[model samples]
Each structure stands twice: as C-alpha cells, then as structure tokens.
Target: MKSPTQIINRELKAKKKCQGNPTKKYFKELIDYYINIKTLNEFCFAFLKIKITAKIAIFYFF
Candidate 1:
C-alpha cells in the first residue's frame, strides 16, 4: 500500500507535467501565426511601393 505522502507526490508530479506542455504548444502556434502575418504584411507593402514607383516613373518619363 502507498503512503499518503507518496500518493500526494505522484499527483503533484502528474499535475506539474500536464501544466507544462499545453502552454508551450499554444505559444509556439501563436508565434508562428504572428510571424506569418508579419511577413505577409511586409511583402504587400514592398510590392505596393514598387508598383507606385514604377507608375510615377512611367508618367514622368513618357
């Protein structure tokens, strides 16, 4: 038979292990999503800048 202290220690260890894993996975997914969105925003801004510059150059030269 297990002593009361041993049972409490086992329960505590189980709870600690459970608590550690889910938050790490959740934050990793959130970071990945943020990075993807940031990269997409940057790409869109660069494309617009290039397009506007080309239009202005064409208008001025022709």
Candidate 2:
C-alpha cells in the first residue's frame, strides 16, 4: 500500500496532469479543502439533527 504522503503526491501529480499547470499552492489548497470538509461534516450532522427534530416537532403539534 502507498504511504499517505505518496498517495497525496500521486494525486497532486494527477491533478497537475489533468489541469496542465498544477502548483504547490494548488495542492495545499486541495489538502485544506479536504480537511475543511471533515470539520464541516460535524457541523452538517448537527444541523441535520436539528432540522429533523424540528420537523418531527412540527408534525407532532399539527
């Protein structure tokens, strides 16, 4: 199996090949976005939980 760094490098290379001008900053942005999503997933789950609970409460009252 490839190491995490190796996998990341491979992905960056692929992105560069597809885009034709990949920079180190581009890879950095990609990593940042990936991490941001992980953090955002928790927020999304909480939001969904509240939304579902609110819907259930509305149905119960109506």
Model 1: lDDT to the true structure: 0.48
What is candidate 1's lDDT per residue for 7-37, written digit by digit as tens? 3474355446556553444334433433444
Cα-lDDT of candidate 2: 0.52
Cα RMSD, each candidate: 23.7, 16.0
Model 2 residue 12 distance off true place after TM-score fit, in angstroms: 45
**Candidate 1 structure, TM-score to reference:** 0.37
Report how far off residue 58 is in candidate 2 (Å). 0.1
Model 1 worst lDDT window (10 residues):
26-35
Estimate, for each residue in 1-62, the C-alpha lDDT of model 2 and write its tens digit. 33457545855665675464444444454444344444565446535644564576468656
Task: Tell me how many residue pairs clash in candidate 2.
Answer: 0
Q: What is the lDDT of residue 59 in candidate 2?
A: 86
Indicate the TM-score of model 2: 0.35
How much is 41 displaced in model 1, in angstroms? Answer: 0.7
- Using all chains and alpha carbons, the TM-scores for the candidates as numbered come to 0.37, 0.35
